[model samples]
Target chain A: MAYLILKDLLLQRNMMLLAFAYVLLFAFAFQSMGDEGQLVAIISMVGYMFVMVGGAWEEKNNSDTLWNSMPAPKWKIVGAKYLAIPVYVAFVTLVYAVVSSAISLLQIPITTAPINVFVAALGTIGVFVAASLYYPVYFAFGYTKSRYWHFILIFGIVALSSMLPNLFPEKPAWIDPLFEKLPKLTGDAMFLVVAICFVALLVAVSFLLSLRFYGRREF
Target chain B: MESILELRNVVKNFTGFKINGISFSLEPGYIMGFIGANGSGKTTTIKLIMNLLHLEMGEIKVFGLDSRQHEQQIKQRIGFVYDDNHFYEELTITQMTKVLAPFYKKWDWNTYNRYIHRFGLPSNKKIKTFSRGMKMKYALAVALSHKAELLIMDEPTSGLDPIVRSEILDILSEVILDERCSVLFSSHITSDLDRIADYVTLIHNGTILFSTSKEELFEKYSLVKGERSLLGENLRPYLVGYRESQFGFEGLVTDKAAVQAMLNGNALLERPTLEDIMLYCTRGRAV
Candidate 1:
């Protein structure tokens, strides 16, 4: 599994450099806008790009057939791919933090927050969820065949999220209390605990689903 | 005899083609040549044995272990080489080795290096820079370095110069000299199999035509050529893939002795080659 992950990393090593350069550019551009939260989005987007690039490289090279022929269980191969998501997210976050810190030390007038671990964790979680949703579908249909489905998924989520509020302009009476109480719950430490558990469960289920799809796939 | 690989009544189906219930086995200390035409299910059968493709029916066992239930364990002892290169093309040979070496328990760096040196492969060169033959040599080096008990190669000699093909055949012969290792090689190049194979399994249109010792196959089939006037109605039933030209008629006959008796000095009977057998059995004229 470690070797498989290492292989993916090596194949996508160029992405790291690209991500670093992108981070530097975005940081410099958004520094004047005074938006620090965009750094998290940048990191998340880079992480997402790594997953797609890795999948594309694998498909182009037909590495899945090679990996399937190796002495590893099919589930382990799929598990390694899922495991790479967090590893990549962490690497992207690290590069962003480093670039942001260098800009701060040079006396640039950027809105540099001191690398909040909580925000980074949240960003990683968000990217992981998105990847988890995408990768299982990618594995099921492969890169070329899954592109339209991926477009549909992204657009469907965007459409649904944007339409829900317009359709229900009058907040339901039952939902107002829950929305009112949500911030109070988020401020409590136990909320972080619950969030972590939920994210972990989602990731676990996603891994199992990807594994099931990958196991049935023929090279 | 200890069987190293066994397939029993194996069946796989696609939309228009099916690998119909084929069964064959290879014993240790010998090479089995899997002979078939293009799209004749050779690669498909190899994929099935590797469990890359799911089996619709029947079972495959490698080293007496079920291919599916114990795939990792079974694969640990098996080495595979495909017709096309399957490694990372952008990575150098050394980098590719680093990625793949740790997967097998018995990988020997010295053995790999020895092959690298012998094959004249540049360690620092990217695979995309290597020619087709060089890539195949690299694949063979990797396959051999793993101390694999069974070597399964699919059309490894397909598109190579004759000299390079001969070199590969020589290396395959050397690999099988270990006595504990066996090879299941598939190719349309029957000449290569003629040089190295001990057992032959011929498949055509998703069916096994014959699986027997190479010597026995030669003994059973004969290439008979005679004057066109001698090809009578009486000999029509015995002729396979009979071809007629302005000068004579030639075809493959299974019962060489009986055919010779019937012809009685009118026809010239020669030992049938693997190519002759494959062509006659698969696409030969019936009468």
Candidate 2:
């Protein structure tokens, strides 16, 4: 199983390098806008392309028939994907750390310690959770073959959902107070809890979806 | 001994066309030629047995186990080579084998290398750089390296030189000697099958025409090139298929001895080839 996973990743080194290049470009773009935002974008783009589309692209590239010929269990194949996300995240984390250290050492104001670092890590997790939840939907819908349409559907929905909120705004209540008033918890603490729960919920949901979709697939 | 594979009432449908109720079995230590033309459901039936394609309605048993229920277990013992070249183009032959070897529990690296040398494939060249024959030899090498009990090949010799084809057939024959492994080799090239195939299965237009011994197929059937009146309605049922022209009538009939005994003239009873069967069978059907 490990061999299968390792081979799957290694065989597509070209695609991985391409994905890495794309992520780097996007990260730099985000950095120019706001260095704080770059981490999230870098993590999301890599997770989506590296972890999600990796297998999908391989299948479309006609490696699916070869993979299907192997004797390994389907769950082992799925588990390999689960293992791969952290490996990709770890790679991103190393890059983020190196950039942050270099910027701070150089006395560059662009690098913010602790808060920026924490947000970046959380954002990475948030993106991981997002891809984990959504990739299964892509798989269920056979997105490998229908990638052009799926690309539109995924990004278009994201664009529309964020934009549509202006048409119907909700009023905020009086109890929307700052942490300074209560001396109880900070905004950072609230974000921490939200990120953990969101990520955990996403992982659980993705596993359930995989089991559901996998049952019907002939391969 | 039990048969290596058995398909009982295996029915697969794609839209309106149906590969209807294909039932045949191959015993251990035999080379079974799955003879068919293009789109004759040879590949489809192989896919169904391999669990690459789902059976619409049928039971496929491989080595006495239900194929659907125990797919992974079944796949472990079966080595498959498809009609097309399907290896990663960028990877070298050595690199590709290194990647695939770990997936099989019974993979013997030494044996794989032996076959590689035997086939004379270059060790370091990228698969994309190899010619058609080299690519096929590489595939066969991969197929043979793993300790596979059953080899299911679909048109493995479509467009290779006669020498390369002979090399492949020779290796296949040798593979059978080791463990009595059964081979289901499908091809349009009857000469290869005739030279090596112990048993034969003929499929035409989605359904199997006949599945029997190679000797029986050649020995029983003959190409009778005579006149149309010689083939009367009384003898039409025995005639598998025929073609007519201004000069005379030529047809294929099974039960060659009966035909020869009936008409004593120069009713030529030539040895029927696989292509002859396919051609005669084609003539019977309306175009």
Candidate 3:
């Protein structure tokens, strides 16, 4: 499993460098947003993008087939891919923390926190949710066949979020109460525990589904 | 004799093609040549054994262990080389080996470096810059370095100059000299197999035409050439596949003694080469 992750990292070493550069550039551009949470969100998105790039490189070189021929169980191979996501997220987070700290030392008016645990937790969970959704679909259909499905997923979320406000001219019955209690729930320890458990459940289910799909796949 | 690899009633289906009850076995220390025409399920069968493709039905056992049940164990013992290079094209030979070597438990660095040196492969050059033959040599080097007991190569010599093809064949011959190892080689180039194969299995249109000792295949089939007029309706029944031209009629006859008696002094009968057998069996008309 370590070797598999190492292989992907070595293959995408240049891409990782470019991604780090992009994150630094984007952090400065979005500095005026004055919210460390938003910057973390951007960094998280970049981290997740590397997962897709890794899959693309595998498909481009047809190394997936080669990996299948290796002496590793199919499940371990799939698990390695999922495991690499968190590593990427951590690396991205660390780079962002360092860059943001450096910018502050230069007396820039960057509104950066000292690596707030809450924001980091939120960003990690957000990336995990996104990866949990994307990987199972990608594993089931592979990179080439899943491109349209990925687009549809992104477009569906955007379209739904945009249309929901207009669909109910007055606030919806469930939305009003949920938004009213959202501030209290945000600070609740119990709510954070439940959220973590829910995300873990999602990831476990996704991993199992991806394993099933990958085992039966032909080449 | 111990069988190293066995496929029993193996079946696979694509949209329009199917591998119908294909079965063959190879024992220790012998090379089996898998010959077939284009799209004749050679690669599919190899993939099935390697577990690269899922088999629809039937059982495949390597070293007496179920292929699916012991897939990782089986793969660890078997080395595979595909027709096209499957390694990362952008990585240098050194980097590629570093990525692959960790997966094999018995990987020998000395052996790998020896092969690299012998093949004249530059360790630091990227694979994209290597020619087709060099890529194949690199693949072979990797396969050999793993101390693999079974080498399953699919069309390893498909697109190479004759000189390089001969080099590959020579390397295969040396690999076979180790009594603990066996080879299952698939190729359209029958001449390569003819030089090194101990057993020959011919597949045509997803069916096993024949699988037997190489010597027996040659003994069973004879190529007969005769004047066009000499081929009569009575002799037509004996020919497996016959072709007629302006000068003469040439064909494959399975019953060599019977055909010689029938044609007596009217034509020439000689031992059939592997290519002759492949061409006639797949393309020529059968009696």
Candidate 4:
């Protein structure tokens, strides 16, 4: 299993410089959104880029035939993609830190976020959400077909994020009660446990769906 | 003893192509040459056996176990090499092997390194830098190093030069010396099989023409050449397929003795190679 993840990392090794460039790009683009938004954008965009590139490598190499012909099971192949998500997340986080540190040391005018467990957790969750939606399509239809959905998802998020303020000029009445209850919920450590469990459950369900879809796929 | 591999009434369908109830089996300790024209379902059948494609009907058995139900177990013992290089091109063979070696229960690094050294493959070079023959040799090295009992190769020698092809064939011949290993080598290059195959299975139009021993195949079919004037109505039944020209005529004949007797020293009867057999059986024009 680790080998499978390592394979993706090795394949992506040449792109490390490109990945650093992407970090700088995303940092520049999201600078106006302040630290949290910039951090989340860098983590999710760069992390998801890894996932897409990994899938592309499989298609380009036509490697499903290789893996399926061997003793490796479908579940392991599907599971490895999900497992690698966090690794990608960790990598992007590290890159963001280096870039942020360099900006700080050099007194660059770029706005940067501090690395904290909470913000990093949010970024990781963001990646999980995107991957959960994207992978099922990828496994069902392969990379070539699923890539359109990836574009749509990205566009939809951008469109929705921009439209949300317009759609609700004022906060909904229900959000007020929920926001009030959120502080009390956060006061207890149980909320963190529940949130982690929720993300885990989402990932587990996505993994199962991907496994089922990939199981029926023919190389 | 159970056959090393078996397929009974296996059927698969695509939009315009189908493998129509194909059946053949290979025993242990031998090489079975799967010969077919392009798009004749050789690769599809191989994929079916490897469970890379879902079987629309019938059964595939490897080592007496159901292929789908026992896929992992069966695959552990089966090594495969396809025509195209499927390993990651960006990574060196050393890195690629590190990722794949753990999946096979019996993977032997010593055997792998031995084959690599023997094949003269560079360990540190990315696969993209390797020549077609080197890529194929790397694939073969991985396939052989796992202690595989069944080696399923689809067009492994298709695009290689004669020297490299000969090298692969030699390794295949040596691998079969174990007496426990069997090979199903699929190729359009019939000459490779002529030198190494113990059994030959011919497929045409998604159907199995015949699956028999090489000696039996040679005995059953003969290549006949003679004057175009010798072509007659009575001899039409024996000719599988023949072509005529201003100079002479040649064809594959199922009944060599009858054709020889009919021609009466006017025609020459010779043992047909697998290429002749495949060509006549699949593409030859009747009469």
Best model number under lDDT: 4
Better of 2 and 3 by TM-score: 3
Model 3 residue pairs with clashes: none
Better of 1 and 3 by DockQ: 1
What C-alpha RMSD separates each model from the true structure?
A: 2.3, 3.8, 2.6, 1.8
Candidate 1 per-residue C-alpha lDDT over B117-150 given as tens digits, one digit per residue, 9 for 90 to 100: 9999999988999999999999999999989999
Q: How big is the positional error of residue A83 in model 2, measured in Å on the Cα after superposition?
A: 2.4
Instruction: Name the docking class for model 4.
Output: high
Error of 1 at B49 (Å): 0.4
Error (Å) of candidate 3 at residue A195 is 3.3
For model 1, what is the C-alpha lDDT against the true structure?
0.87
Q: Across residues A1-219, which tens digit of lDDT does each residue of candidate 3 receive?
A: 887788778877887778767766777676665575566666567777778888888888888778888897878789988888778877777877777777778877656555666667666777778778888888988999877777887788779989988998896689778878755565546666777888999999989989998877888
lDDT of each residue in B163-226, candidate 2, tens digit only: 8898899899899987668899999888898788999898877888788988888887898888
TM-score of chain A of 4: 0.91
Native contacts recovered, each model: 0.85, 0.58, 0.87, 0.96
Which is better, 1 or 2, measured by DockQ? 1
The segments of candidate 4 whose C-alpha lies over 4 angstroms from its true place after superposition are A173-184, A187-191
lDDT of 1 by residue, A74-191 (tens): 7877888888988998898789878877877887766655567666776687777778788888888788887776688779878998999998999788887887876556463666
The reply for model 2, stretches above 4 Å from the true place, is A15-24, A32-35, A95-120, A141-144, A157-165, A168-194, B233-235, B285-287
Highest DockQ scorer: 4
Give Cα distance to truth, residue B174, candidate 1, Å.
0.7
Looking at model 1 chain B, report the run of 10 residues with the lowest lDDT sum: B278-287
lDDT of each: 0.87, 0.75, 0.86, 0.92
